[model samples]
Structure formats: structure tokens, C-alpha cells
Target: MNNSLTNRLGELAKLFFKMGVISFGGPAAHIAMMEDEVVKRRQWLTSEHFLDLIGATNLIPGPSSTEMAIHVGYIYAGWVGLIVAGASFILPAALITGGFAWVYVTYGTLPQVAPLLYGIKPAVLAVILNALWRLGKKAVKTSKLLVIALGVAALVLLLNVNEAIALLIGGLLGMFWLHFPAKRNSPEDNTNLLIAGLTTGATLKATAAVGASAATASAANVSLWQLGLFFLKIGSILFGGGYVLVAFLQGGLVEEYGWLTQQQLLDAIAIGQFTPGPVLSTATFIGYIIAGVPGAIVATVGIFLPSFFFVAALNPLVPRLRASKWTAAFLDAVNVSSVALMAVVTLQLGAATLLVAKAPYVDFVALAIALLSAVLAIRFNINAAWLVLGGALIGWLFFTLGLYPIK
Candidate 1:
């Protein structure tokens, strides 16, 4: 109601709208873009506050960047801003992906985006690596914490423990081990205790194979509600990032329900990675395949709906998370854990961009571009968007010159 609040809301809308349109390269780039906007440019919040949002997002199960949008919205203007900011940020990607889905269904195959991704993927990896280094300085404050981070990376990469489970373990250990004595009367202290007590206390299914049985035929008959609920479940409990959705959709949609073929599923993922906004909109593409326009709308909403609630529930406690010694330690552990997971995923994505498995997939040009993007990002301090665009331009140029095929 207040004019000052109204102006801040406008700021949120304007910035997030632009970000929604250009928030390419994926989560790391999105986060970096947000940091540059909210933390560095507008001075709406501190770098510490921004980092806390990032860490808190890791605590939840939704898209981290989208949740952060909701959380930041709450930070600025409570519930109204939360809805507006998230919607503003997600609209562009959903619409673009919806168009792509329409095309794929009309044609048997998705359009080739190999050239665009050829450059974007490596830049994305580099952006994440840059972010990891920057956040690590703040998150890794002690040797014990450093060990916790390394331990998490080991558990995840070597033993293949679930990332959510790893985060839980770190938080629990930090709750006990990181506990420190403090007075109760200070409002800040009370806030921290309430947050540490309540926040830290919040500690939080596979498909079957396709069959020739009658069940197989029946499974293909998915309704709109079934489609929505299906993606809703995936959005709620999904961990390990959007990449993990690959295995999930393959199993559930292709194997269990037989609603999607493996090729369709792969095409959906390609659309997701190639487009902007939440990568989970792959659910939208999958939904359209099962139902229609209504299916796409429902599935998109289902996949992203949980994120708003999670952010609303968790955002208020962030200040407390920053203030309490106990919660702070828990967050520290969580941040380090996040960095570890991020590093592992970045490496995997970077390797993928190399495209060196065999002919057709193999591209020495992509490899060189990736390395160049890394160098430009690291040594020159170029904005990630520029690096991504530069990569795209060069990739298109090479294809145009007839040096390498665009797949």
C-alpha cells in the first residue's frame, strides 16, 4: 500500500522480468545475475544475505534459482512480491519451452540446438565454477568445515549417497557439534533461537518397467489430473538438481506409465537445457505429450508449485539462520555441501560439452570453445552472459564456415 513498497515491488518486477528473458546458461548463471543485480547494483541486500539465500535454497527440493526468486521477493515485499517475482521470472522460459514442445509433437524430432548448447554448456560450467570459488571463501571458514565439505563431496561422488541425505547429515552434525552458548533475551538472540530451533528441526519412489500386459495399454491413458500430480510429486521431492530429473522421467513416464518414449524424453531434456527458466519445464513438454495444451499448463504448474510454498516457509527464517550461532553453523555446513555438489555437477557438465565420446558427438571445436570460455571467464572477469553469447556466435560462425557440422 505504501508508495515506497510499491516502488520496491516495481524494482523487483523490472529486474526479474529482464532476468527471466535473459537468465540463460542455467542456475549458476541465474544466481550470478541475481547477485549482480540485487547485491551489487541495487544494494537491496548484502552479499551475506544473498549467499544465505543461495544456501537456504539448497536446503529445499525445488529449483534453487526459482526458489531464490520467491525468497528474494519475500525479502522485498512479503507474499505479494513473492508471487509476482516468481511469476515474472518463470514466464519467459515456460512460454518458450511450450512453443518448443508444440514443434516437437508436430515434428517427430526436436529442432537441433546442438550448436547453441555447444557453447552455452561450458560457459555454464565455468560460471558455476566461478560462483563456487566466490561462495567458498565465505562458506569455508574453518578447517573442520572444510573437512565437512570434502566429506560430503566424497560421499556423493564416490559412495553415491543421495544429496538430500548428505545435506541432512551435515545439518544434523552441525546442530550438535556447532552448538554454542548464548543469552536468550536479546531480540536477535531470540530470533536466532527460534530460527535455529524451528529451522534446524525441519529435517526432511521408483517406476516399474513397461510391460506387454493389459497394464501397459492402460498406463498410456493418462488424464490431465494424473499428469499434474505426476509432475507435482517430482517437483516436491526432487533433489540433486534438474539433471536428476532425467532418470526420473525416463523411469516414470517411459517405463512405468509408457506415456513417453525414451526418444521423447531425451528430446524434452534437450529442450529444457537449451531453453531458459526452470529446467523442470521438461515436465511441460512431457505433459503435452500425455494430454494437450491443458496438460502442458497443468504439468508446468505442478512441477513448479511446491517451490513457492517451500520458499515462503523457509525465507522468513533466513535472517535467523544468519544470526544464530547454531543455525549459522548448520548453514555453513550446508553451504559447503552445496559447493561440493555444484563442483561435481559442473565437472560432469564440462566433460559433456567436450563431446569426445565418438564421431558426430565428438567436436574439437566445442572443446576449444569450452577452454576458451573458461579462460575468458577466469582471467578476464568477463560477464558470463557475454561469454555465453561469444561462445554461441563462434559456434554458429564455425558451422557457417563449413568447418564443423551443426549436428
Candidate 2:
């Protein structure tokens, strides 16, 4: 490799590896951190381009943030950068989760991380809000786009629509609404198109359901190959987000195969949630429980392989999509809708982090951390990784001093 290419690869490795360790909260938080690093701090991409990547990543099935890392890597380096960036980000999370899985298998219990999460969740909210503010400016370029964003947010926050579906709705809305008066199509043609679209969507969902059921019925010994194939299928077709993986695993692993109990599944999800990087790393925990180290390695590789492929295929088309007026409108709407989803998630996280269910009803300390973190990030331009670490330290201190009760 040339010296310049080698240097870029080194940069990708350093940046994503650190992000893997410190990216808490989930995909939204992870994406937010990436935006800060790639767009704001490093200037590796413009906010507009970053927003496009987010829109495109949302349209895909795999982990959005991990794909974003891979997308950024490709933009910076090449196909090699794609693999390096993805592996660098994924390796730390997989290793950390693997260690947790080993402990869970050995001790039959999980670690207590409530306090660390208590502080980290609020700080993550701040980081997400900062990203939303920055990206929304670039995305909501017109009043119509703003309306589409709001409509998508309502679909998700009120109607409980899936986020991926919401993005599709936004894209379609933007496509037709923004590209009006250009051409006229027969009403019959429009109706047929709508019907075909709906039919295709329904067929895909039904097919996935049937596939899951078939896999359940055919459950057998958890061989390395079978486990890898199971996750590979999921990585290719599983949409919505990592949380949706639960239903599939519950049905296939717990109900059909008896490979994992309900509690074990829940604990695996818990470990995935609390740890940094992709929630799909829960596959690592489950694989360790079901098979062994080899299973964990296979599962991690299988579940993440599709994202690398998907991003590589889609990244090159983004600039082309922007080049076409109709597709450009669609991308614009998708971009705004992606931002809207992040907004809704941030609000949900805020409520969950700042409000107590029982006595007191409000977590003032968390609120303070969120507010302070936001101020630092917005005004002082503090790095997100440090903010997350600081939140964890504060949470630990509070827990140690008996200031904050463990959740």
C-alpha cells in the first residue's frame, strides 16, 4: 500500500476502535457520536453527506451505526478501509461482550451495571440532541421537508410504526410531493404501483415469518455451521433494529430449539444493551452459551457480514441518488425522517432516564448530567467519548457515596 493509503487506514482503525469502546446508549447514540467525530471534529464528511449516509443506513437491515462506520471508512479509504473500520469498531464490543458471556456461563449471573448506565444514559441523550440539532439544519432545508419529518415522527411516536417503514414512507412522500408538475401518470398506473408496493412489503414480511417458523421447527444440535447460518440469515433480512431480533430468537431459540431459556435471552440482551457498540453483539453472548468460543466467533462474523456487503453496495449510489431529481427528493425526505426518528428516540430516552416510576418521580441528578453535558457539547465542543466516560465516573461516584440508588 502507498504511504498515504496506509496512513488513512491507520486513522480509520484508531477512530473506530475507540468508538467501539465508548459508544454507549444504542444505535442513535452511536450514530450521534459518529456524526460528532466524522463531521464536526474530523471534517471527514460534510453534515449533508453524513445525513445522506444516515438516511441510506436506515433503509438497510443491519446495524445502522456500524454500517455508518463502514460507510465512512469506504469514503475515506476504500474496500480495505471498509473491512478495517468495521472490524475495528466491532472487535472491542465483541471482545467485551464475549468476556461477559464467559462470566455469565461460568458464574450463572450477570454484572451490576445499573449505576454506570444511570449516568451514561443521560449524557448519551445530550450527545444525540447535539447531533439532531446539527443534522436537522442540513436536512430540513424546506418547509415541506420539515412537514415530512414531523409526519414521520408522528407515525413512529404516536402510531407506533416501525422506523424503517417510517423512512420508506418519508422517502415516498418526498418523491411524489417534491417532484410534482413534472409528469402526469394515469390514475390506473398509480393505483397499480401502490398495490404492487404494498403487496411486495406484505410478501416480504410473510416470507420472513415463515422462514423463522421453519427454522424453529427444524431446530437441531447447535453446530457451528447452523449457528453461523442462522445469524447470517438474520443479518441479511432482519430489519427495524436489534430489538426486533428478540422476537426471532425467542421463537427460534427459546420456543423451538430450547437452546436458551427466557432468562438467558433477557440477560444476553441486557449485556448487549449496556455494553458499547452494536446490540447485535448479543449474538456473541448467546453463541457462547449455546456452543463455545468458536460459536461466539462464528456468530459475530455471521451477523455482521451482511452489513459490510450492504454498505459497500449502497455507498457508491448515494452521490448518484443525489444527482437525480426524483431520487434526490426521496433521499431528502429519508434524511429528514431519519433525523425525526432520532429526535423521537432522544425524547424517549430522556423520559426513561430522567423520570422515576416510584417515589420522587424525577431523577434530578440525571437531569443535571444531561443538561450539563449538552451545554459542554454545544458550547464548548467537548468530545462525546469523554462525556460518556465522565458520565460513568459520576454515576460510579454517586453510587459509591449513596447519592443515587441502584436501579
- Residue pairs with backbone overlap in model 1: none
Error of 1 at 141 (Å): 1.7
Q: Which candidate achieves the best TM-score against the true structure?
A: 2
Candidate 2 lDDT for residue 192: 40
Q: Local error of candidate 2 at 201, Å?
A: 6.8
Q: Worst 10-residue stretch by lDDT in candidate 1?
A: 205-214
Off by over 4 Å in 1: 1-3, 180-221, 354-382, 405-407
Encode model 2's per-residue lDDT on 1-407: one tens digit a residue: 99999999999999999999999998999999999999998999999999989988887778999999999999999999999999999999999999999999899899988889988999999999999899999999999999999999999989998877888888889888987745675564455444424532642473365265334322236788888888887887777776688887787778876878889889999999999998999999888888889989999999999899888877887786776666777788889999999999888888899998987888899999999999999999999999999999999999999976866
What is the Cα-based lDDT of residue 238 in candidate 2?
A: 73
Which residues of candidate 2, in runs, are more than 4 Å off? 184-220
True lDDT of residue 105, candidate 1: 79
Q: Alpha carbon lDDT of residue 115, candidate 2? A: 84
Estimate the TM-score of every prediction. Answer: 0.84, 0.93
Among all candidates shown, the one with the greatest lDDT: 2
